[model samples]
Target: MVLLLFDFFFHPFVPDVLSLWHQEFDFYTLLLSVVYGGIIEEIMMRWGMMTLLVWLFWKVAARKKQVPPYAVFWTAILVSSLVFAVGHYSVTALETEITTPVLVRMVILNGFGGVVFGWLYWKKNLETAMAAHICTHLTMQAVLVISTILS
Candidate 1:
């Protein structure tokens, strides 16, 4: 609930976010985003990368004969989230047509979203965090569709 509000309200003030949403506003686009963005994105970012990092960390801990606790779990979330943010920045860099202002807004929005996902992981668990992330993407797509219909 809080995260949804953050995504909605913060987007307008952040320039390109609302613009990006508007750009993606359409029935076909919304459907594609739900399938690709909502599911595939979360799978790659949270489940794929983050899960791999956690596994590697576990292997290291096992080699050292030390069992990591909750702190280690939280640290893993933070590290993975930072990596995700960096990846997002790289994507922005690759976009030749993206303006400086739009790039800045994208970085901020993606980074903020990553942070929220990390916090959710810490608060609940990986499953909950992934659900929240997916929800955000799905909700964004829905908002785009609804707004297009209204306007």
Candidate 2:
């Protein structure tokens, strides 16, 4: 996975990234993250927010067209991803101070996840995005487990 690659390649130089991701991980938290991050987030973000944006954009920009333009979809994806990235600031701020590096990290990483999920939702369905989100969490958890085992 991309995250694993980031960890594998950059972890030696930037070990703080691992710490920045999560301070604690247990079975319950992992389950909760998968459920909430995967199912709930996809529902709210892709299914709800992105869909809403697409509808609005389609209505305003391409009302007569049967299918929305690619630009509309990209606009919706970018906006929704922006919201998703900013939304993460709340949790990070609650945990610790939101420094410039933290802000950049969350924006790039979470925004990237949002875009991927949004693309899946647009191309496939809500379930596809949900599955991808779940897989992402599982992969991250697997990385954590592997690192814990190694160290």
The best candidate by lDDT is 2
Cα-based RMSD of candidate 2: 2.5
lDDT of 1: 0.63
TM-score of every candidate relative to the true structure: 0.61, 0.88
Candidate 1 wrongly placed segments (more than 4 Å): 1-21, 58-67, 89-101, 118-127, 149-151
> Which residue window of length 10 is worst by lDDT in model 1?
14-23
| RMSD list, candidates in order | 4.2, 2.5
Q: Residue 110 lDDT in model 2? A: 83
Please give the lDDT score at residue 82 for candidate 2. 93
Task: Check candidate 2 and list the clashing pairs.
Answer: none
Clashes of each: 0, 0
Q: How close to the true structure is residue 101 of candidate 2, measured as C-alpha lDDT? A: 62
**Residues 34-139, candidate 2, lDDT per residue (tens digit)?**
9999999999999999999999999999999999999999999999999998999887676657676667766777888999999999999999999999999988
Deviation from truth (RMSD, Å), model 1: 4.2
Candidate 2: which stretches are off by over 4 Å? 5-24
